[model samples]
Target: MTTTPRRYHITTFGCQMNKADSERMAGILDNMGLISSDDPNEANIILYNTCTIRDNAEQKVYSYLGRQAKRKHQQPDLTLIVAGCVAQQEGEALLRRVPELDLVMGPQHANRLQDLLEQVFNGNQVVATEPIHIVEDITKPRRDSKVTAWVNIIYGCNEHCTYCVVPGVRGREQSRYPEAIRAEMEELGRQSYPEITLLGQNIDAYGRDLPGVTAEGRNKHTFTDLLYYVHDVPGVERIRFATSH
Candidate 1:
């Protein structure tokens, strides 16, 4: 008799940032030898890369998690994970609400999915929400589109808009080095990707948190600088940006 390979499904709800996070997480799962499943129920690992931008979005995630949590009872080996904004905002409290969750991680922790899942494989429930310097994105993203791609030039938000949860969930602003961003874009260009979108919560403020200034008292590493730096990447025909506050 032969056992089937473990499969994973990710249910994502939110903006493009969340979608980008989901792709990176899926890439990590792929690297771990898990295949993608079109249906959540059929997969041995079910992950909800949740959103809390709206009250109903948060409630919807809970309802979905409830179903999977119940399913876990019948399939004891099933692994459940809640990641992205909701995971960051709720932290350990999420584990209290959904005891079936094997891993809870924030958006900033996306690159560390492999290690987090390893802990889960060891029979430990993990919650990683503490803010840290954003890690460089090295994992190959299982991108949703071959024609276009979303590149996060900066991670987290530094704004404190009273009505927004992004600042709390995504943490402080940390920009990726210009060289790193260019390398990723160039690779995408080589792969025949036509367009790339620079993503951020407060895109206009890209390099504010970084340590640099020009003689004119202006930040030397602004988004405009990034644009000029990457405009000529080999085969990339278009460049765009989103989520400016």
Candidate 2:
């Protein structure tokens, strides 16, 4: 008798960032041999990659968590996780409210999902929201579209726009090396993805933290410079970006 593979369902709230994060988390689950499930109730792993950008988005996360938290009382083996901006902001408080959660990890910890989940399987509850230098995202995101993809050229933000929570939840600026970004795009091109959107909380500020100097002795790795570098990625028809602030 063969046992069925565990299935995962991720309910995401807010922005392309949240969607992109969910895709990467899904990729992590897929790499672990977990299958994606359409119905939340039917899955063995249920993840809420949440957002705190709005009151409504935050409330929706709690509502979803409540349902899953209650279900976990009966299904002790259920692996429930809360991840993304809200996870970073709330941290241990989320684990208090939804004590059934197996893991609560921030946006910066997206690529560390496998190692974190290993801890969960070892009978540990994990919270990983502490600020850390953003690691280069090497995980292949389970892209939502075959034609378009989100490539995180930069992680986190340094700006403190009056109404923004990104700088707080995502930590300070950290740009991926341009060579790594190009390699990711090149792979996407080979996979036949025609459009790639480079993501950042404050895209205009990308490359400001990287170590480089212009011919005139100014910072060299501006967004325009990045565009020129990535534009020639073979098979990529269009390149785009978000949140120029």
Candidate 3:
């Protein structure tokens, strides 16, 4: 007897950060031998990479989850996941709201997709919202663009602006090592992706959390310094960045 091949569909909502996170998770799934599916209803695993920056976005996640949750009743073997900001914010409450979910994981836990899914496969419902120092990305992203790519130079934010939910859900500022950032860019350059966007919740705040200082008492890894650092990577034609702050 032959077993059915695993298939997955991911629906992403919100910012470039969320989009980047989705691509990474897709890479993780791909590495696990799951084929990508365009239709959520046809896939064995369905993921909603969520956003909660606005009330409407948050509400939309629940609506999407409702439909999938209903489908889960008939397809008892289907795996359901809610990821990104809403997962971070709602935590176990999401499981309470949607008991059919197999995994509820945060933006910080994006790189741990495989491990969490392992727990799910073991007949466990997992919630992984606790803050962690982000693992250095080693998984290749299933990027949507052939010519452009997103390189995350930093994760999360430090600001507490009353108008934003980013800091609360994404956790504290965690800068990727500048060396790691450049290594990713170098690989993208090798892949012939001419345009690369550096992503951050607060782009200007890059490298402030790193442990380094210049002899002149200046930050050794400031965003300006980073720009100068990776400016001449081979095959990269253009670079851009996003800032929520």
Runs of candidate 1 with Cα error greater than 4 angstroms are: 1-3
Assess every candidate by TM-score: 0.96, 0.97, 0.98
Q: Pick the candidate with the highest TM-score.
A: 3
Question: What's the lDDT of the predicted structure labeled candidate 3?
Answer: 0.93
For candidate 2, give the lDDT of residue 89. Answer: 96
lDDT (C-alpha) at residue 192 in model 1: 100
Candidate 1 C-alpha lDDT tens digits along 17-60: 99999999999999888999998988999888888897888899
Clashing pairs in 2: none
Number of colliding residue pairs in each model: 0, 0, 0
Instruction: Work out candidate 3's RMSD over C-alphas.
Output: 0.9
Which digits, one per residue and each the tens of the lDDT, describe model 3 over residues 1-245? 98777999999999999999999999999999999999998998999999998789889889989998999999999999999999999999999989999999999999999999999999999999999999899899999999999999999988889888889999999999878999999999999999999999999999889997999998878999999999999999999999846
Question: For model 1, where is the 10-residue window of minimal lDDT?
Answer: 153-162
lDDT of 3 at 60: 88
RMSD of each: 1.2, 1.1, 0.9
Model 2, position 86: C-alpha lDDT score:
91
